[model samples]
Target: GGSPALGTRLKYQRARWERKRSRTAKELLETEYKYLEQLDLVLTYFVTILKAKGTLKPAVLETIFGPLESLYSASHVLSLHLEKGNLGAGLENFCQSLDLYGHYAENLEHFFCSLKGISLFCCTQEQVRKNKSFRRFKKLQETRPQFQGRVLEDLLCLPLQRLHQENSLQLLRVQKLLKGQKTQVLTPGRWYIREGWLLVVPSKGEELKRRMFFLFSDILIAAKPCHPLHPLNSNKLSCQAVYPLQQCSVDKVFGHTWSQGGLLSVSLPTLMQVLFLSWHGVSCTHWSYRLLVTSLSSGKEAPLGL
Candidate 1:
């Protein structure tokens, strides 16, 4: 009787594990589909339309888009495989096509420079700005309903950001498969929510530092980029600080002092620390608002100053 009961318990645990695996796979596939759609939007609306209208020359267009066509094709192929319920095949296809992503990453800075009229291509910055056809094309993109308020910079960051998210999800899966083996510092219920680059103002009269922040369910982690001089650790992040949401408060800084971008002051009263963060061409207020909401939901009684 004892052996049979133990066997049944083991079977039940296996079934639960299978269910979790299925759910995770489904989530991965759905996210891939959504990402593919976004890529298509960029290709169809920006690339194809610009080419058809002859708004920019081929070289200029290449400078602006830079491997976007290949990225869209790869994403489409992966999405098709995922749609057929073959997550392994889809991931394998993506892995084989990673060189395309690498190429894009290498050229990302050039793409941004061209977009911002920093004169990376054959045309000068003045030529780009004064080009009537390019201005019309940019205006059209701004009016596209599909973009939902996102600019070209936001769209361009999607691939790398998605890569980070995939890594986080894969790590989570590994943790679950190990049955909480304590492999890493990941807590049981904590999960990744969002992550991005932010300029952190450490203090008055101090230089603004670039930092990569990962927002978890209950904490915000600030990490500094490894120095380029150390090639081995160049791609890694060194965690500088972790702010627990339960003891944090976020407030927007008012006035015209920060004219270039929006500012958010994150106060950690318990730790006696304050962090002022800003993002270029992105809504710092929106992120601060979300942080405040997360803090409130974490059972904190602090009121957010708008």
Candidate 2:
């Protein structure tokens, strides 16, 4: 609703500002040179502060997939809608309206601030990873609780690195993936070849299920002995096979196997994997997943129905 009005005013003001700035003095070469020097310094300072502005940092969003990125990249209006409103086709419509609103609406400074806090929120998650230091800081027991925002955010991410040394898992690659993403760019299909881990990226067309399907398929194809999602034993109902989930087998129908000229079938193994992963704390969000993936002992199921 706001894009058109904002667009025209922004365009006109920007053009006016540029024109005023570009007008040069015919007689004052020395003053013009100093003006250019000051302009450059001011521009540099703006860049530096914005870089530290939180949401713009790539390290803040590694596990959120590009969904967070896409949300931040939309017209500030649309991103706000996505975060606050329901998830569905309506948000997509707002994102698509970029053609009419122009980039100004999408690139508002408030949009950037929101992303950083969200990024801080994503990277500093305490539940899934459960690092001792992070847990200590997050709790009211010891560390000062008043500090929030990026200060606490980075403090939280500091412990994820320690997971590599303790767990014998290569978490450095994950850190690199988080760090390599540039300002305002959210890469959904980020896969680290060293880790052999492919994050399931969500697209505008696909919701949670499609991304999960791709992640499930990718994990199934890249199995090792006694791994969490190897799909070790399969029973076929039709064209599809049932891979009984390790836990939560009775909790929910994980996946259904399809048949030819017949009825539908379901697999329990996939459900177990999903349930097992969920129980261990892996999630679609960065903060939650970071906690889960960093400290997990691997292949151990949480006490579910037991």
Candidate 3:
């Protein structure tokens, strides 16, 4: 037959067919890979949500994670706002402190070791090196977390502090309002408010519990009604009467609010959430609603279209 050269036609035809098949296969693999990747991420997030379901709110996942799998998602807008907050100096200072600590281990380490009663006489260097528990304890004590100049404290104040002194609201009342959602507490509790003070007592504990009661009562009379108080007074003995708790030991509350001014452990997550709420308002768009009002028009987003 005089149709074509057998070798040349067959080679060209095979090459073209191979190219088409390769292209199709590549596209199919890419699509399948993307679908599989998405499925994997979804599965991981579902697992996290299941583990945390008892703790985290399900509805907030949408606003934070973009309609699905909101695990570990924090708000970008809120982050930007916090970056622009008055915490600039505090953060810078905190960084400086960390740098100093990193650069010099002798002084800080020596002090903490002394605090822990390392007893240089009793322990040989080799023994200290082999002691895993000692090493872990030392590591934890050194890194037990401190914050910038009350970065969180200032954040908690950011929302209400903007109000004039005359109209300034009580922090407890506002906090109560914000946290009014219903939930069961396995540890049962009781709180009573009297004359601008809130008293809380745990169910267990009887003898020293009376001490807690007496302590709070004294604090109330001293606070003069519009003061912020820390949960525990570190010093209960002899503190200069700073406020209500002033009469108590200054050390008892020295590291706490009221008498004040000592390094204290702050809850990082709660601090972050509070900062977000303050910067964004009760919900995320509250700031935008406040900003986008026209002078000529009433500047409110129309009431919920319910």
lDDT of 3 at 82: 34
Ten-residue stretch with the least lDDT total in model 1: 297-306
**Cα lDDT of model 1 overall?**
0.64
Tens digits of lDDT, candidate 3, 1-306: 324565455445445434543443344344334333443343353335433642223432221122222211212222232344422222222222222222222322332234334543122334545655544543443342332222221222222122111012222322222212231111111111112112222335532111111111113211211111213321121111111222222111132332222111111222221011111122122211221211112221211110
Query: How big is the positional error of residue 95 in model 3, measured in Å on the Cα after superposition?
Result: 57
- Output the better candidate (1/3) by TM-score: 1
- Kindly list the per-residue Cα lDDT of model 1 for residues 251-289, writing each as its tens digit: 777662444566678888777556656665344644665
Roughly what TM-score does model 1 have, to 2 decimal places? 0.52
Q: Please give each candidate's TM-score.
A: 0.52, 0.15, 0.16
Point to the candidate with the largest TM-score. Answer: 1
Candidate 2 vs candidate 3, TM-score winner: 3
| lDDT (10s digit) by residue, model 2, range 1-306 | 347766565455445423432231111223323333333332233223334543333432333222322322333343333343322222334424323222222222213335345633333444324444433433432233333222433323222222122112112212222212231112232211111222321335443221111111011112211111224311100111112222212222235221211111222343422321221112222212222332231232211101
Off by over 4 Å in 3: 1-4, 48-306
Worst 10-residue lDDT window for candidate 3 reads 184-193
Q: Which runs of model 2 end up more than 4 angstroms from their true locations?
A: 1-75, 79-89, 93-306
**Residue 187 lDDT, candidate 3, scale 0-100:** 12
Query: Candidate 1: which pairs clash?
Result: none
Per-model lDDT: 0.64, 0.27, 0.26
